[model samples]
Target: MNRKVIITCALTGAGDTTGRSEHVPVTPQQIAESGIAAAKAGATVVHVHVRDPETGQGSRETAFYVEAVDRIRESGVDVIINTTAGMGGDLYLDPHDPTTFVEGTDLVSGVERLKHVEKVMPDICTLDCGSLNFGEGSLVYVSTPDMLREGAKRIQDLGVRCEMEIFDTGHLWFANTLVEEGLIDAPPLYQLCMDIPYGAPADSSLLASMVAQLPEGAHWASFALGRMQFPWVAQSVLLGGHVRVGLEDNLYLSKGVKATNAQLADRAKTIVEAMGSSVATPDEAREMLNLRPRS
Candidate 1:
């Protein structure tokens, strides 16, 4: 087992989880504070996503990202900032009229999606490898090959690390193809996203299989949503992969109890130490992931 594992804390995701958990940060200040807290709690990286402060709804605003990143930077937190470039791909098709797009659909081009990342130049940004049936009904997370190539190239050009997000086995194959095409840089970074509906389930067998499929010399982390968050932390380390934990993926520390991002990071750190693995610091994580420092 790899003793030096990096922990990434997903501070606030652009999901419908505000009302469900009060600890989910909504404003830029709150998000920055949560990120700093996670870093202090042993997370080497902070994966961030902004929301509409007033409504607590997910947004794709550059101003929100700028504010959040500024706050985190000003706070002098020694953690790698990993922004979300996975937005602007939601496609909710109409059930009755399949040809027509639904109201909540926010389909955007690849260039539009990377605007924030380009402007802020965060140390790392997410690039979802492939599309999948996001949830029940006609909802789908659309990430086409052309779009993926465009996003990957842009992130590479900006000199920011792209954290390839894989939700299923097919996604892993597609990511490997990117490496073959030279779109993804050497020593690729991957996040094995599990437990999402219609994606790879959060099971030890499945996690092991996914880990085995990763390209040689690739740095990777694995996380599960909701209740599986803590368990998957140990499971990932056991499988020779890193770990991620936060309110973005899971809201509860236990049954019917909500957890903040700092709490989640602390819990994951506890598990990693218990397994005889030491947590990687931000500088070590930057070197391992091949991320450039912000200017």
Candidate 2:
């Protein structure tokens, strides 16, 4: 029964969703515009993942991040920026031999992954807690414990809040360990990711279980993919957590209806208000998340 829920709209994600939606922003300018639009539509925070302009695929280029973030910051919008440090751990293996790296593979050292986070210096950045079989392909996400420790330490030293992205129950376990080891600061923030194929399923009961495992007084948010996105808004608020929406997790405003990032954020705001809670403003969100603005 949380009264003030924070709405984080993930502007663009490192997924194969570019071809699926016309609204999925590819270039840096489009991504920045989408972030601003989502903020004006009632999102307190915007999660960003830059994409290749030509191929519309996920890109780990620091220049893309720089351009997008610079545009958003220069817009004078009062929204918290959260960049994704989850890019470089991708593992595309050969179908015949898993030992051999394939074309789409982009595995790098943990600190190497945060190259942009280090340079861009956003208010907040994500640290994916563990690995997963990314999708229905030979692709796997590899975020080992060592990687998590190093990334967590780096983000901490950078004076940026680390949003531990837990895809499954076990990832939550390791995330707690990071807290215990003092890698992440107190009242750590977490994003309980749900319904990414082969990860945590998007079930209410499972979400409750994960909520029960959260650190005391920790700030957290949860999201589901596709059609379950809207429902999870109510689900998360009812469970005393925050909510996330936007093109990163889902692309539809309704069945047969393509959605812009702002539309999804507006819909999330409507749902939260309907649930008898108000969406937090960016300044309020920063206060709740212990985030400070950068100059």
How much lDDT does each candidate structure score?
0.91, 0.93
Once fitted onto the true fold, the runs of candidate 2 whose alpha carbons sit more than 4 angstroms away are none
Clash totals in order: 0, 0
lDDT of 1 by residue, 112-231 (tens): 899999888898899999999997999899999999999899888888888999999999999999998999887899999998999999889988888888889999999998888999
Model 2 Cα lDDT, one tens digit per residue, 68-168 = 99999999998899999998888898889988998978889889989999888998999999999887989899999998898899999999999999999
* Candidate 2 TM-score versus the reference: 0.98
Model 2 Cα displacement at 153 (Å)? 0.4
Q: Which ten residues in a row are the worst by lDDT in model 1?
A: 286-295
Candidate 1: residue pairs that collide? none
